[model samples]
Target: MSDFKVFPFETEKQWLKGRMIGIGGSDASAVVGLNPYKSNIELFEEKIGRKIPKDISDKPCVIYGKKAEEYIRELFKLDYPEYQVSHHEYHILQSLEYPFMQASLDGELVDQDGRKGILEIKTTNILQSMQYEKWKDRIPDNYYIQVLHYLLVTGWQFVVLRAHLNTEWGGEKRTTVKHYFIERSDVEDDLKMLLEEEKKFWEYVESGRKPPLILPEI
Candidate 1:
């Protein structure tokens, strides 16, 4: 059994506060300097409540993504009927072993065989979807890291990433769903490295010290 606890938050504000108390799946990529949109320093500033606040609520992409999440989840269920999908009641989970490590899962999956796994739903535009090959074999690094972070917190053996592609083809709007399975063992080494980085990052949060900004290599 996993030492994971789920906390029910009454409001979005409370949920945000809970998220600030620990490192989350979305924050994992930023902690490792892999999120192109955010840097480790920015994440540090946000966590510490510095002057600069990064907000994504008004972003069209973010808004669309949020709106498409449930549709994507349903698509996954339709494609994999053998698996039972259940939404997290509170959605916020913490690892007892590393209380500072947290996860916000989109859904939980139980296969007919009684195996459990995590489900992550994503919405990407057609152009972005085309950049990757088969999703079952490959995924964007940032998304991959996010899933690994969730697995770390939940101690799940595997994760299913379901993505909805919103695009137009031949003068018609289309929504296509794709899914990928990620086994924890296949990325154990990578997760270990991320864990070390997260440990160091949390130290900065605890001490009110800022992590150095990572500049683009190019």
Candidate 2:
């Protein structure tokens, strides 16, 4: 029998590809988004068919390394805060012969107090009422594989999400934890799809073939 590996399809991969690029079609003076290199408000705005509102745009909320460390520390040591915790972001990358293979990771836990989890903290604006109730109750699809991906990177048995809720438009601050138990087989499936997509992506990069989506096949 032939031994060609099959790729596991992940919607996240298609999602990631789009984000890796620079902005798409947002006018600078009129748009409100992160001006940093990784911000793609213009491109993402085009895909979603809505102006990426300045309030909830993926602007630099917190820098991911030392700054992120300070943020976590503040969360843990703030004046009478709830659920003191710490976290960090790790870019898990398996390099090929040249460079790049499977690359993705939101954060890693070095001192989580025996908690094997990833913290996917999201901040949003509330026009009328607090929308955090939805995320508090359930970690939606956007953050599903993301949490799992962090778990896979850390080699943890399970993954949990610690979501911090805050609002720019007057809302109660809240915290919640959601758990996801993905098995070895599940992570393996994600990896296979990831590698396959990586190969195809490298091909595209070499040949200058633009791919519609670069999201992982989780």
Candidate 3:
């Protein structure tokens, strides 16, 4: 197996840093380095209490994500008319205690079957969580932007979340499936603006200056 462990110890901090930079529209996988420990794939399956297919991990880097993503799509009823694999490359900046950020992403998905769009895979227990509204929406922006920013970069036709509820805990035996389709122009604009701001921040970082003390628009 791979030498990766679960998200552990300083990993939470690293995850936090990556999360913050992500709000500023940085690349995903930017903070993975900070996580000295990582979760095993088995833990992922076990926690989800589902069997990850044998070939799931064998796909080419470009298509590797779909292995798990598709199962989630099928289970969640997320529309995946067709899809194309998209690869992620993180650009690291800074070297403080946690470094700038070790961001990575749900990667990108290109819908090929008239469903031309972006694919984002989410794993959460949100199924039982009550629904909230925008403006008053309590959902984390970092989480939304992870996919938003990726969509901003690629100009994909649409953005889709092929997600599953991680209900393997709480003695629950069945998993929950879900999907979110974001095909809004306003959101795309907002994400682009956010990415622009992040690019500005990156320029400062490249010049060895600390990032501005800016709070996210939660």
Q: Choose the strongest candidate by TM-score.
A: 1
Could you tell me how far off, in angstroms, the CA of residue 175 lies in candidate 2 after the best superposition?
Answer: 5.6
Better of 1 and 2 by TM-score: 1
TM-score for all predictions? 0.88, 0.42, 0.48
lDDT of 1 by residue, 1-218 (tens): 76699898887778877887778988899898888788889888888888455677789988998777777788778878988998854458999999999988888998777877899988876655445453546777788889989988988788998887677767888876777888888999998998899999999998998878766443
Give lDDT tens digits, candidate 3, residues 69-182: 556545434344455555333322222222332234444555545444555665544334442232122224545655555554444556766544444447766654555667
Candidate 3 backbone clash number: 16
Residue ranges of candidate 3 with Cα displaced over 4 Å: 1-70, 73-115, 125-139, 168-170, 215-218
Cα error, candidate 3, residue 165 (Å): 1.7
Give me the displacement of residue 32 in model 3, in angstroms: 19
Identify the candidate with maximal lDDT. 1
Of the candidates numbered 1 and 3, which has the greater TM-score value? 1
Model 1: which ten-residue window has the lowest total lDDT?
127-136
lDDT of 2 at 200: 54
- CA deviation > 4 Å runs, candidate 2: 1-107, 110-138, 148-157, 168-191, 213-218
Clashes of each: 0, 12, 16
